[model samples]
Target: MLRYSLMRLGIFAGCFLALWGLVYVGALPRGLGDSNLLWVLLLSLVISAPLSFVLLRKQRDSMSVEIVEKVDRAKGRLQDNRTREDAV
Candidate 1:
């Protein structure tokens, strides 16, 4: 789970840095280099989301399986405790 999340963050960071670099190089509008920080961040997120969705599909599936297994185990434990209490 941690690995998947960190990887997603790394992707976003990479995109953000790349965007910032483009802005720095005058490829994007000149004023947004430092003046429009929020726009830059929002654009980065928009770009990163689709990339992460495609790139991290396997990681996300693995994390989902791990989470589901943990939930099932916890539910089973809860049922066992309930049975013990009812018997008492």
Candidate 2:
């Protein structure tokens, strides 16, 4: 689970960097470099950061629920085993 989370985060970061780089490159004029491009990049990151956090949180929450359900099923099986042993 830890590894999975790490990989997910790494992928997200890598993609974000790649996108920012692409935008920066695309915004460069043919004959002049504009400083305002930095502001645009900053704004884009600010907007995307929160959106990404919300998305990642939702995914993590769902994964956690799945893990909990699996544990609950295992516990039920254990209880059933104990009940059978008692009856015998």
Candidate 3:
């Protein structure tokens, strides 16, 4: 899960930097005042979301399966502990 999150963050950073460069080079328009940074962040999310969904599908699926397995194991342990307490 951490790996997947880091990968998404990396993608967003790459998008933001690329967009920032475009603005610097006069390729893209910059927003007024502090809205410039806000625009970059929002645009980065819009650009990165689809890219991450497509590129990180396998990693995301594996992370989810690992989480489910962990939850199942925790539940099994809890059930066993409850049974032991009841018998005592």
Best model per lDDT: 3
Error of 1 at 24 (Å): 0.9
Ranking by lDDT: 3, 1, 2
lDDT of 1 by residue, 11-87 (tens): 99999899888877878764545566776688789999999999999999999999999999999999999999999
TM-score of candidate 1 versus the correct structure, residues matched by position: 0.91
Ten-residue stretch with the least lDDT total in model 1: 30-39
Q: Which pairs of residues collide in model 3?
A: none
Q: How many clashes (backbone N, Cα, C below 3 Å) per candidate?
A: 0, 0, 0
Per-residue lDDT for 15-78 in model 2, tens only? Answer: 5576567665876332235645465545556656666676678677777898999999999999
RMSD of 3: 1.1
Task: List TM-score per model, in order.
Answer: 0.91, 0.46, 0.91
- After superposing candidate 2, which stretches have Cα over 4 Å from the reference? 1-55
Q: List all candidate RMSDs to the true structure.
A: 1.7, 8.0, 1.1
Poorly placed runs, candidate 1 (over 4 Å)? 31-34
